[model samples]
Structures are given as C-alpha cells and as structure tokens.
Target: MPWINDAFWQQLAIGIAGGLLGIIGALLAAQLSSRGKPKKELSYDLRIERALPEIGKELAPHVAIRYKDRPVPALYVVTCKVENTGNTVVKGQQIRFDLTPAHPVLETYFAPKPEPEWEIEELPETEETPGPNYRFGHLAPGRKITIKIILAAPEEPKVEVRDFNPTEHVPVLPRTSTARANVQVRARIAVALLLALLVIPQAFYALGSVGDIAAPVVQLGLVAALAPFAPSLIRALVHLLFRPAPRINLDRGIVMYDGEIRGVINFSGEPADVPDSAQTLE
Candidate 1:
C-alpha cells in the first residue's frame, strides 16, 4: 500500500523538516535586517523668543520685549535662534509668541495682556541684520537664524518670561463662555458615530444569520449615529445656509495675568480667549 512505503515516508519527513528550517531561517534573516537598520535622529532647532511688548500702537516692524523682573521692573530681551543642523532643507510658517501669567495669584491680581500681538514682517535682509519679528521661512541644512526680543517690565512689578512658540503654538480660538459646551457636544457625536458603525454591523450580521427581522436594528443604528451629531451639524448648516458672516470684535482686549503678582492684564489688540467648550474637553 502507498502508506506502507518506507522510502516515500522518509522523503515526506525530510520535506517537512526542510520547510520548517526554511521558515526559521527566513524569520532570523528578517530580524537581523531590522536590527541592522539605524534609526534616524532629527537635527533641527527652532526656538521662539519670549513674547515681549511692542513699543506702541504703531506697528513696529521688528523686535519685542519681555519683562524679567516684575518687582524691580526690568526689561528682558529674549533672542530666538533657529538652526538647521539636519541634512535637509527646513521650511516653516510665521512665528507667533505669547506671554502668559505663571500663577493663579497673578491671574487675579496683575493686569496682563491677552494673546501677544503678531508682527508679520519680511525675512531678514542680511545675515548680520536678521529681523526679529519676521519668521524664518526656509533654512538650508546647517543654516541658522536669530531673533531678538526686548522686554519692558511693569512699574516696580515682578515679571517673568513664561512661554514662547514657533513650533505648534497653542491655537488662539474665538472666545465664548459656551465654547466648551459646543466642543463636548461635538466629541459626543463623534463617539456615537463610531459606536454605531461597530455595533450595527455585528447586529445586522447576527440577525441575518438567524433569519430574524433586521430592519429595526438598522434603523436604530442610524438614529443612534445621527442623534448626537444632529444639533452641531444643524448649527453648522444654518451658518452656512444663511451666510450671516460671523463678526470678529477686534476692539475687545483679552485679559492676561502675571505670574508673580495676581492681577488682570490687558493686551493692546483684541485677542480671542480660549473657547469654554475646549476647556471642558481638557
């Protein structure tokens, strides 16, 4: 019988062993290849100068100031330096800076400015006279740029330079106390949609296999997905449909607080405060 042939059985056993060895060798080779590949390290530094006050209402083309000593009220100038140490060219957008009060006491007591004003200027004319306000648009590999900030301390106040940005600065949104609620509603809607997609498919499959009624399951799933998203979607639709252009009140000043002293501060131009809806998500 075929099953009783020793030579055939020996050949089968050898084939199986060879296949197993081949698989094991392939796995080892893959592991070795992965291990031999070196991870790339990023080589670029984009530091933003501390946000400082502009001299006046007249838009100054360059330079900004941040207060270092609030009690003595001394001005501190933070210079931002961007260096492209990597091998590739780096491109960036406008540079934005903000000075926020450090502590809760300062938030209540001191008068601080809202989001810092933005100065969009052309890039520096020469390497020697690199402009401070203007963003470095492109930096060739191994190139570096610097920006200077001049700080003016409040009268006999304690000041500290807290934060700066060029990379992924916090988004300044239109401020409304109800903004947080809107964000929460949006998030809930998104979650409900995801759940509907997952659960409805499983329910439909089960019902189909059992030959049971599936119409109710499908309807309920659709409703569940639509319920939470409906309100926000409707609001958006109305805004789009009516074309009632939203007005931005540029006159209002956003309040900022000092870290060392507790007080409300004012910025020159109207800066939108964080939306309340966003705060709720946090």
Candidate 2:
C-alpha cells in the first residue's frame, strides 16, 4: 500500500509521457534522415548510329544478320562485330547486350506473351521485324563486338545497351524502367534502418524503468510489422509512378516476305534476299 502512494503514481505517469515523447522524436529523426541528402542528377550518354548503306562484299561473310524472332511491319537486321582490341590475352570475360526500343515502340514490341499453361487463346500477330541475334559467351578484353540492328522504319529507332559486370546480378547502369524503382527502394531501406536504431534504445530504456515486459514487446512488434513491408512498399510506389512495359513472347518461324514489298509478315519462313553483303558495323 505504501508503494502505491501518490509519488509512485506520479513517477509512472512521468515514465509514460517520456516513452511517448521518445517514440515521437525517434520517428521524426527517421523521417528526416530517410529523406536523404539531395544529390546531383546523374547523366548517362548513349549513342546509336544507323548502319552505313554500303560495305565491301568480302566483309559480308564476317557479318551475320538474322531476323528478330518476332514479326514487324519493317525489315530490320542486327549485326555484331567482336574483336580483341587489347594486346593482352583476354579470356573468361563474356559480352552481353540488351536493346530496349523507345517508348511507344517498346511498349508495343514488349507486350507480354501469353502463358502457355493457361487456357489456350489465339496468339496476337508479332509486330516487330527481325534484328541481329543475341550472343552470350566470353570475349577477350581488347575484343570489341559491334552489333548491327536494322529495322523497318517507324520514324527512327533507338537502342540502349545494358552491360553486366563479371561479378554482379544487376548491371551497373539502370535501365530507363528500373532506375526510379531502385532509387525509391533504397530510400525506404535507409529509413527503416534508421528507425530501428533509434527505437531499439528507447525501447530498452522503457523496459528497464518499468518492469513491464509489454513495453519492449510493443516496440519489437512495431519494428517487425514495418520491416518486411519496406521493400514491397517501394515496389508498389514504382508501379504506381511508372507503368511497366508489356511482355511479348516470340515464337519460332520465319515471317517470309511475299515480294509484295509492303505488308505484314505473320508466318515463319526464310527472309527473301538474304544479304551476303560484307558490311561490318564496327
């Protein structure tokens, strides 16, 4: 009964007020730090050139051209040249490149392909012309591979190359679509970590002042609830901010040119006038 005196009640009230204030302070710090220091925007330079019209016939054998596995209104070819430009005996290094078309075209070309296991549905006609085939394997350091991609004109075509370093799952440069997503996700993670640092100490302090175990339990519960969602929240934000491109699935078959010079090719078949021209894009 003596321990339940007015002094004891006053102390308990003070502790509760302190705990609430501590939580608010911690949350504010987290939010401010999470905003992060402003940074200068990075600029990436990319260049695409149209393949020169003429090349020596002898060079044609070295240059390989193939239709993209998809159909298109215009005729396009992708050419690659690999050379060991370095004097060192380069080995074990592989070269990979991905070309993403510009906005409307990319959206159209990358329309998601149907899932095969799902209910059968008629496939949509491919609206993309053939381009050079993609290659994966090691290339020497001094070696350079030039890919020539030709497509039937829909105004002008732009291509971007994403390079993968030997040691990473993701490439160094962000593709136009994924860059903003990554930035938002990183910010969310930073915020979550900062919050954890601030909340944990205050939580321990509250637990010590009052032998009440519930204080610590509630603090831990808040952390647990917020931790897993940080990543998902960032992803959702990206989805809301920028709509991703549609997926396109391509089937094997030649979209033969029927000599008409101006029409869509749907069936798979060999391309007419398979050029033996020696034109290197390197």
Instruction: Tally clashes: model 1.
Output: 27
lDDT of 1: 0.39
Model 1: per-residue lDDT, tens digit, 1-282?
766587666655554444344334433443443334332111222233223343554654353432333332334444444344334444444443333332111111101211122222334334343223244445454554444444444422222222223564322222232344344445455554545545544544553432123434444545544565567756655554785433333223433222223346445754556665433220
Question: Per-residue error at 58 for model 2, in Å?
Answer: 33
Residue-pair clashes per prediction, in order, are: 27, 34
Whole-model lDDT, model 2: 0.43
Instruction: After superposing candidate 1 on the true structure, give the runs of residues whose Cα lies further than 4 Å from its correct spot.
Output: 1-163, 166-168, 176-212, 245-282
Candidate 1 root-mean-square deviation in Å: 19.3
lDDT of 2 at 239: 65
